[model samples]
Target chain A: GAGVSQSPRYKVAKRGQDVALRCDPISGHVSLFWYQQALGQGPEFLTYFQNEAQLDKSGLPSDRFFAERPEGSVSTLKIQRTQQEDSAVYLCASSLVPVGRDGYTFGSGTRLTVV
Target chain B: SQQGEEDPQALSIQEGENATMNCSYKTSINNLQWYRQNSGRGLVHLILIRSNEREKHSGRLRVTLDTSKKSSSLLITASRAADTASYFCATVPGDAGNMLTFGGGTRLMVKP
Candidate 1:
């Protein structure tokens, strides 16, 4: 693809329902990252992946939140028993290298509403 | 947590004027980058400046980084109505693993 792509541009879920968001990063991008952005706030890091290895999970808010990039090309973020506070835009970004001096390309994001 | 803080939560300027936004971070950073986001849209990378470099320019954008003050600024020259968007600053911590920490953005509105 020409750019990073995310699925389900908008989602409405029940407070206790589970939801999954997907990201298809730019071809050959070696690093993938997930971020959550609240209304009127900047994106907060959720997790990071270097290829198929999950190098960092410290930013995941809870055990219920899980992300996997098994193939090192596409990734998915799953949130179980979603809460009202979880209502936010889930962003996906990819970098050609580790986010050092390079800028990341971002997806449109999945606006998840846990009502 | 967010490592950077951008000032002037909102800015309004005329189309032909220049707009500047400032950002400050709390940690040693390998580099600083800027991004823009229109309402309901994804972020678009603008520029990146390495810690060793004090300034960098790309087209109509000029970025300055002050490692001593742990601050960076983005200047958009000859702003246009189409340039209206939320501008953010993100840092790659020199000591931490590869993750970009973003700041609360500055919303700019350029009137035509």
Candidate 2:
């Protein structure tokens, strides 16, 4: 892909419903990251992956939030029994390098609205 | 918790003027990065400055970092209406590997 791609640009889910957001990072990128951006706020880190390995899950808000990168190319963020507080934009980014020397490429994001 | 914080939650300026946004972070960092986000869109990487470097430049953007003060600033010269967007500062905490912690961000509005 030319850039990071995210699915379901917008989503509306009931309070208890489950939602899955997908991300297709730039081809051959080795690192992936997921973030949640609340209204009028900056994106907050959710999780990080180095290829197929889930190196960090410390930022996941709760057990309800689960992310997987089984193939190391595509990733998904799943939120179970979504709550009102889950209403926000879910962003996915990928980096070419494992460290901070190179910047990341971001997806347009999935805007989830929990009512 | 967010590791960085940007001041001047909102900034308004006219085209051709210079806009400056400041960011402060807690704890040691490997590097600092700036990003821009237009309304309802994803962020675009602007510039990055490593801890060892005090300043960096890219086109109309100039970034300065002061590790001693744990702060960084982004200066956009001759701003344009196209530059109107929210600017954020993200840090790679020395202890946090590749995960980046972002600040609240500063919203800049450049009127043409």
Candidate 3:
């Protein structure tokens, strides 16, 4: 079975530039999540989607971080006006349900470097 | 925010030796889970122990949770070089969703 997948394993952008990270969740998985992990730290939640409907965005650092999952399977996390503070790995995960009885499967993530 | 804290921050052990890592959290949780990451990229789910269940085992991996202490421990018996990676403990509280709060992981290096 195909697990979650992310594109452009690595990206480098200049300050003030915008970047987009993509995630492909497993088929029929209703719950999707985005997280940001800085160097030597645990991942922090960004947003969550259930069947195309975003349930939470409180973890988003600021307005510059936006996510969308139109088809309920594919998701995108876009960061605007990149900053060195934004340099980190963005992780995507999906699970069968929201209550989390079944653990999530994560992608390799995209490492972004803002110079 | 990191849901829990793990220590010793880094550990070095040899093959055939036992490796132990500990984690502690502040909030009430439905379950606690462990994950392993290699090179800090993708993380693989290792095990999950419910708050009510004090201990659970999968093969050579043993996870023990102490609700009163709000802590958990992961013990690997006869570790291998493949076990060298960062291990994290995630606390899934009663947030109505499975959103996890992870901790700063413990880096384990196994010298074979």
Each prediction's RMSD to truth: 0.8, 0.9, 1.0
Residues A58-113, candidate 1: write the lDDT tens digits: 99999989999999999999999999999999999999987555999999999999
Candidate 2 regions exceeding 4 Å error are none
Q: Interface RMSD of candidate 1? A: 1.2
Grade the docking of candidate 3. medium
Best by DockQ: 1
Please provide TM-scores, in order, for all candidate models, with all chains considered together.
Answer: 0.98, 0.98, 0.97
> Could you arrange the candidates by TM-score from highest to lowest?
1, 2, 3
The CAPRI category of model 1 is high
- What fraction of native interface contacts is shared by candidate 1? 0.87
* Residue pairs in collision within model 3: none
Off by over 4 Å in 1: none
TM-score of chain B of each: 0.98, 0.97, 0.96
Per-residue CA lDDT of model 2 for B1-112, tens digit only, reads: 8889998999999999999999999989999999999999999999889999999999999999999999999999999999999999999978658788899999999999
lDDT of 3 by residue, B25-102 (tens): 999999999999999579899998887899999999999999999999999999999999999999888557568889
Supply the global lDDT for candidate 3: 0.92
TM-score of 3: 0.97
